[model samples]
Target: MPLGKGELTTTATSLHILELIVDHGWVTLRGLVEETGLAKSTVHKHLSTLRANDYIVKEGERYTLGLYFLTVGKRAVEFRESYQLVEQKVRELGSRTDAEVDFTVEENGRLILMFEAAGATNESTFGTGTEFFLHNTAAGKAILATYADSKRDEILDTQGLPATTNKTIQSREALHAELEQVRENGYALNDGECVEGYRTVSSVIKRPNGSALGAISAGGPAYRIDQSRLKNELADHVRSATAEVTESLVEAQSTL
Candidate 1:
C-alpha cells in the first residue's frame, strides 16, 4: 500500500526531530520549536511520533535521548579507534604528571569527553562524558587551531562561541587571537576559563587524513596548575600524549 503525502511528510518531520533530540539531550517543546523552526502543532505531532518510536522520551515538560540512543552511543564508542588509543595516552599522562587527563573529541561542533583517567594525586572540575562549548576549552582551542581560516569560521558560526564563564573568550575576534597563539605555541591552555580554580592544557591529535581525531587534556587545581606551569609543563606533556595517541591510531589503522 502506498503512503499518502501527509503521512510521508509527518514521518520525515519526526525523523528530523529525533535527530535534533539525539544530538542534544533534554530540550523543551519551545526550544524544539525554535530549533526546528516548525509550527507548534507540527513539532508536537513529530515529538509524539518520536516518543512512540522509543527514540525519545519526555521528562516533565522536556524531551531527551532514550535507551536507544545509549545503545547506539555505546556501539559508536566501541568502534572508535581513537577512543582506545586516547584512553591509553590519558592513563600515561595521568601517571606521569599526577594530573587528571581527559580524551575529548569534537562532534557536531561540541567537545565530547570520551574517556578520562585520574592520577593518584589529581583532582579536577570535569568528569567523564562531560561536554563543553568548543570555543571555551583548551581541547577545543587546540583542535580548532589546526583548521584553515574558512573551516574555523564555519565551526565558530555553528558553535556560536557562547560564554561559559567570565574568563571564557566571548568574542570571535578574541578566540581568533587565542587560536593564533595556539598555532604558534604548539599547544593550548585553559587557565580557569572553563571553570574557576581549575586549569588545563591540551593538544590536538590528527587522523591520517590530517583531520582532527580528538584532543588530550591534562588538568589540575589552579593552585598547582598556575599560568606558568600551564603554558610550559602541562602544555608539553599534553602535546607528547597527543602525539603518542595519534601514532598508535595510525599504526592500528594501517593494520586494518
Candidate 2:
C-alpha cells in the first residue's frame, strides 16, 4: 500500500495476501485469515482467484507459491541486460578477490538482491530476492545515496532504520551524514553493520542522469577486510566493478 493511503482495493488486499504467502512459503487459509484479519469468505475468494490463475498452489489445505513466478523471474532477469552483464562482473570479482559479491537494486523502495556469487573465500550473506536494510549494508547505503530527498524520506519513514548489529546506523541524522560521505567517496562501507563479523565495500551503478541502476558489492568477514583494506583495496575493486557494470548498461541502452 502507498503511504498515507487509508483505503485498500480488494486487489491490493489479495496481492498483500499473496505476498504474505510468498514470504511464509506455506500457509493455510485460516492462517492467512489470522495474519491478514480478512474474513474467511474474503480470503477464500482471493485464494480461489489466485489458485485458478496458478499464482498459488494448493495441497489439501496448505497453500504454496506457484511455479509461474519461476518463469516470470527468469524472463525478467534475461530481459534486464544489466543483470547479465552485472552477473558476469560479480562472478569475476568474486573469483578474483575471493570475497562474496552481490548486485542489488532498489525496487518498490526495497533494496533487493538481483545476483550473488560466493567468493572462493566465502564471505557474504546475500542471495536472489534478499531484501535488506537500506541504512546498513554497503550495497543498500550505496543505492540509498542516489535516491531523491523526498523519496529517501518516504522510504525511511516507511522502513525505519533498526539495529541489526551494534554498529548499524539507527538515527536519521547519522544516516544522512553517512550518505554524504558515500557521495564524496563514490562508495560505501559496511563495518559490521548488518552482521557482527562481516564487512563490505560497495559502489552504485548509475544512469546518465545520476540515478542509480543498482549497486555492486564485495563482502567478507571483518578479519579478511580490515579498515585499511576496506578503504583502499576493497574500495578499488568495488569502484571498478560498478564502473564496468554502469558502462556496459549505458552501452546496452544506447543500442536499444
Candidate 3:
C-alpha cells in the first residue's frame, strides 16, 4: 500500500484547543472562548467531543489532558528504540558529571526535550517536554550540524533566527559558520545563547541509518560551565555518550 492524502481532513479548531490545554495545564471552558475568540457554542461543542473521546478530562469546570496522550506518547517512544538508548546514556552521564543533562530531538521545526536527568548541582536546566529553537541552543545546533545543508537552509529561511538572549546567533551565515565549528569540534557550545546565565555542550547522537536520533547535552550555570570547562572538561563526556549510543544503534541495525 502506498501513502495517500486524506480526502476528509479534520478542522484545526479541536487541535488548537488541545494545544491550549497542554500549554496552560487545566483550562476552563470560558477561558477557551476568551482566548480563541470562538463563539461559546462552538467551543462547547468541540470540547464536548474532545472530552467524550477521552482526549481530555474534566473535573468540575476545568479540563486537563487525559491519559490517552500518555499511552500514545509511550508508544511513540517504544517505536523509536533510539529513545530508550539515549535515555539510559543521559542518565549515566548526568550522574557522573553532576550537571544537567538532556536528550533533545527536532520535531516540527523545533527542539523537543524528550529526556532529562539532574546532576548533583542545585541549579536546574532544560526539562523534558520543553521546546526550543535550533539556532540558539547547543543541542539544537548539534542536531542542525548533522542535517543536509539544503534542509538546514530551508528551515532557517522559514523561521528566521529569533534571539532569546543577547548572545544568540542572529544571521544564517553566522549559524552556518557555528555549525562548521560544531562539526570540527565534535560538539556545539552554547554560551548564554539560550538563557542569560546558562551554558551547554552538546553532541549529536546518530542512529544506524545515519540520521540523527537527537542530541545529548550537559549544561549548567555559566560561572561553572565557562568556555574552558565546556571545551576541555565537559565536551568529551557529551561526545562519549553520543558515540556509545551511535555504536549500539549501528550494531542493532546491522543485525536487522
Candidate 4:
C-alpha cells in the first residue's frame, strides 16, 4: 500500500516534538503547543503516544526525555565496529597534543561528532552526537577532500555552502580550491571559520579500500594554536593519529 501524505506529516510532527524536548531539556504541553504553533489537542496526542512508548517521561506539568534514548545511543555507537579503536586513538591524541580531539563522520550531508577527548587547555562546548555544518569545519573538509570529485560535488550541491563566520568559505569555487589543497597536504585547517577565536587541524581516516571512513581533529584557542604550530605541529599530529587509526581499521578488517 502507498503511504499517504498525512502519515508522513504526522511522523515529521512527532520527530519535531522530540527535537523540541531535546533542545529545552524539559517541556510542558502548553509550551510544545506554543512552540510548534499547533493546537493543544494535537500536541497532547503526540505527547501521550510518546509517553506510552517510554520515549519520554512526565513529571507534573513537564516532560523530559527518558532513558530509552540512552539505550538507543549506546547501541548506535557499539554497532560501529571500529568505534573502540577510534576512541582509543582520540584519547591518545588529546593526551599527546594537549588539545581537544574529536572523531567525526559525515551523515546525511552533515558532520556528526562520534567521539571526543578534552585536554587541559581546551574543553569542547559541543558534545558527542552534536551536528555541525560540513563546509566550515576541519574534519568536514578533510573528509570532503578524500571523496571523489563527483561525490564531493553532490554533497556541495545538496548542502549549500552557508557561512557561519566571516572567515567561512561562501563560494563553491574557493571551497573547491581549498579542498584541493587539503588533498595535497593530507590534512585540512580551520582558522576561526566555524567559530571565532578557535582553530582546528584535521586529517582523514581511510578504509582498507582507500575510501574515507571519517576524520580526526585537534582544536584549541587561536592564541594557543599560532599559525606556525597550526601548520606544522598540530597538523602533523592529526595526520599521524589518523594514520594509526586507518592502519588499525585495516588490520581489523583483515581479521573479519
Runs of candidate 1 exceeding 4 Å displacement: 1-52, 57-65
TM-score of each model, paired residue for residue: 0.78, 0.91, 0.89, 0.88
**Tens-digit lDDT track of model 4 for 1-256:** 2345667878788888998999999999988888889999999999999999999999999999999999999999899878888899999888888888899999889999999987766677579999888899999999988888898889989899888899999998999999999989999999989999889999999989998889999878897778888889989999998898899888988988
| Candidate topping TM-score | 2
Worst 10 residues of 2 by lDDT: 1-10
Question: Against the hidden true structure, what lDDT does model 1 obtain?
Answer: 0.82
Task: Residues 84-156, candidate 2: write the lDDT tens digits.
Answer: 8888998898898887888888887678898888866574575688888789988888888888899999998
**How much is 4 displaced in model 1, in angstroms?**
22
Model 1 TM-score, all chains together:
0.78
TM-score sort, best first: 2, 3, 4, 1
lDDT for 81 in candidate 3 is: 76
lDDT-wise, the better of 1 and 4 is: 4
Stretches > 4 Å off in candidate 2: 1-8
Candidate 3, 85-137: lDDT as tens digits? 78999889889988888899998679998999887764456556889999999
Against the reference, the lDDT scores of all candidates come to 0.82, 0.86, 0.87, 0.89
lDDT score, candidate 2, position 71: 90
Say which candidate scores most in lDDT: 4
Off by over 4 Å in 3: 1-9, 121-123
Clash number for candidate 2: 0
Instruction: Give the per-residue Cα lDDT of candidate 1 at 67.
Output: 91
